[model samples]
Target: MNQPFDSDLPNIDAPAIGPPTTDPVPQPFEVKFATRVDRLPPYMFGRINNSLYQKRRAGDDVIDLGMGNPSDPPDPSVIQKLADAAADPGNHGYSKSNGISNLRREVASKYYRLYGVRLDPDTEVMSCLGSKEGFSHMCLALMGPGDTAIIPSPYFPVHMYGVILAAGNVVALDVADSEMFLRNVAYTCEHMAPTPKVLIVNYPHNPSSAVIEPEFFVEVVRLAKKYGFMVIHDFAYADVAFDGYRPPSFLAAKGAKDVGVEFTTMSKGYNMAGWRVGFCAGNSEMIRGLGTVKGYYDYGMFAAVQIAAIVALRETDTNVEKQSRIYQGRRDVLVSGLRRLGWDVTPPKAGMFVWAKVPEPWASSMSTMDFALKLLEEGNVAVSPGSGFGQGGEGFLRMSLVENEQRLRQAVRQISKCLG
Candidate 1:
């Protein structure tokens, strides 16, 4: 105080004035995004596709069996119906967000015919751009930061990706068998704090080609009732079974509609992959939730596509059967050819895929990706590596039966030359 002139030297003894600052301020820039996007894993198919693009550009006759994309076209009559509808300029306006009434009724009737499951078209059914779109939107509508979902491992990427995109936690169960699935669901319900709110079940499952019996849905519905969780049954491959194996709908199980919803897609069944049509049926409340989210996000698909879907559902029984037989033939050709080359593989009872365990001298030496890429380079053949599905999918590979019998046989010959 006496030497006030030396204020700069003795300032350590005085209290600091105004606000305190520790670090340098950042320069103003573009806004930061929500943290959720960073949490997403890189899309596995996109990575595989990148490689495919590069090889194809390099002039390789890449036999692409990597994706489950349908190679065939829709029925000629369906196409004509679509064209007729599109010609009606009045039909080109924004369509109903929850799907047209006739299409919804057709969805209900189809479910009743295929599974003997009755549905109120107006209350329990809603159309989706595709099942994938409905699935992801349902996740957005139902889950958030504190909610969690139980998904079977080695699942279709969307089944899990939807949960992550919703900022919900995921609990995976190894779905090798019915008993394992039941035990895992019960255990998860009992042990996990803040129990899961949703459980996703896909039969004629992707990647693994695991098929579920009707009794499995009975147990699942029972667990859902007991644990107070919702079930999202993906019945996309219902019409694609083979060898006298008819996959039943989850809604056919008693009390299933009380605690869950089922998503069915025309993509696989009617060779309408690019048509972007599907439906969700079951718990009315859940359907309403999906509808609410979808209404805000979309005005629905092209009216022409919806009209054509009606024709597909009403008149495509023989076409569906023919497509199933085509897949079965491809499956037999590929499976038998691989076995002939000394690889142990099983023929799937449903779906257009063969899940195979990595075999022999290559199994121990190469990672799944390495094995897949080597096959692509050496065999000029492309198939999905199991690791792309999830960690549980490792030590295996998935081959799609999308090719015709001749092309499939050629693929097998190519594989034999590389690995056999």
Candidate 2:
């Protein structure tokens, strides 16, 4: 028989004896993790991302439509402003943890101009590294043991994991039907013992590209008042939409400021994804809670970036609108191309993704993860499997609109041949 792995230890692989030696055998120490760390699952995108990297290193020109990262450049005026601000010695120092006065004011002005929701920059607004960071820190600020957050099914990963990381529980409600989603929210709140402590909303939701109308938040505010739950609306895609369909701000609803805050970012609409300029507005009390957590955790965003952000918000509205049109064109190409492949897909009204249903025999024969792998390995196209979002996302694919129209068309052809 083969020897055991511990055979090098004294008497480990030898026959047992009546008496054993008293000499100590050292054991290799292992790093331990906290219970909190144990709560998280492996990153679902790691495998796909790693494979893409490996293939690229091997010199494959993979058509990457897996991530919603913006590929376009920021307005030249914004870039010039950033360079000018960065050159000033005073702008290099640590910034105010709640963001500089002018940046917050600019965010407030945008909200009023866009949605007619007036805000006090001093008390009701703060900047974040990105909306993702703001959402996570807000979870830490507001959630705790025994707290529960109601999130949408087929969710963006952070919406679910952020609450989990704060030692809170989650209840996901399916969001495919906007009306049914609200009804389920009411039903969940009415039944849960402690009721849900928070309700997280993402209109123009990620992965699924589900968009909600303004009246949705009116019902949300009413429900929150009835059940005493706080609301956090992730409005990351606030500035990106198609077909003249403007995405409404949650705070635009009457009494919304009494129950919730909205999170918006310049990433999608401004082609400033790398700048990490994000804002949280409405509900001063909630802002204070988030600001308190941030005080200990960060030094706030870079002042130069904040200055550039101010210029973008004030002067780049046209550029933001143009970016949305570009995404609309790309969406047309991707959705039409996928539909031609006999895939069930819809053109999204807003957001940067086309949530599509996996087609026919292949979908039934293999897991979504395997199907995605097949596309990468055989078709040289990278995609995100729906199951990565949650079980509710199974049998679907979330294709991002980041690639150019030509590249997306190429991806569709490759997908066609791979399945053929």
Model 1 global lDDT (CA atoms, 0 to 1) = 0.90
> What TM-score would candidate 2 get against the native?
0.94
lDDT of 2 by residue, 326-369 (tens): 99999999999988877888889999999998888988899998
Off by over 4 Å in 2: 1-26
Residue 129 accuracy (lDDT) in model 2: 88
lDDT of residue 314 for candidate 1: 95
TM-scores of all candidate predictions against the true structure: 0.93, 0.94
Q: How far out, in Å, is residue 4 in model 2?
A: 48
Over the stretch 195-267, how does candidate 1's per-residue lDDT look in tens digits?
Answer: 8999999998887988888899999999999999999998889889899999989999999999999999999
**lDDT by candidate, in order shown:** 0.90, 0.92
Highest lDDT against the true fold, candidate: 2
Worst 10 residues of 2 by lDDT: 4-13
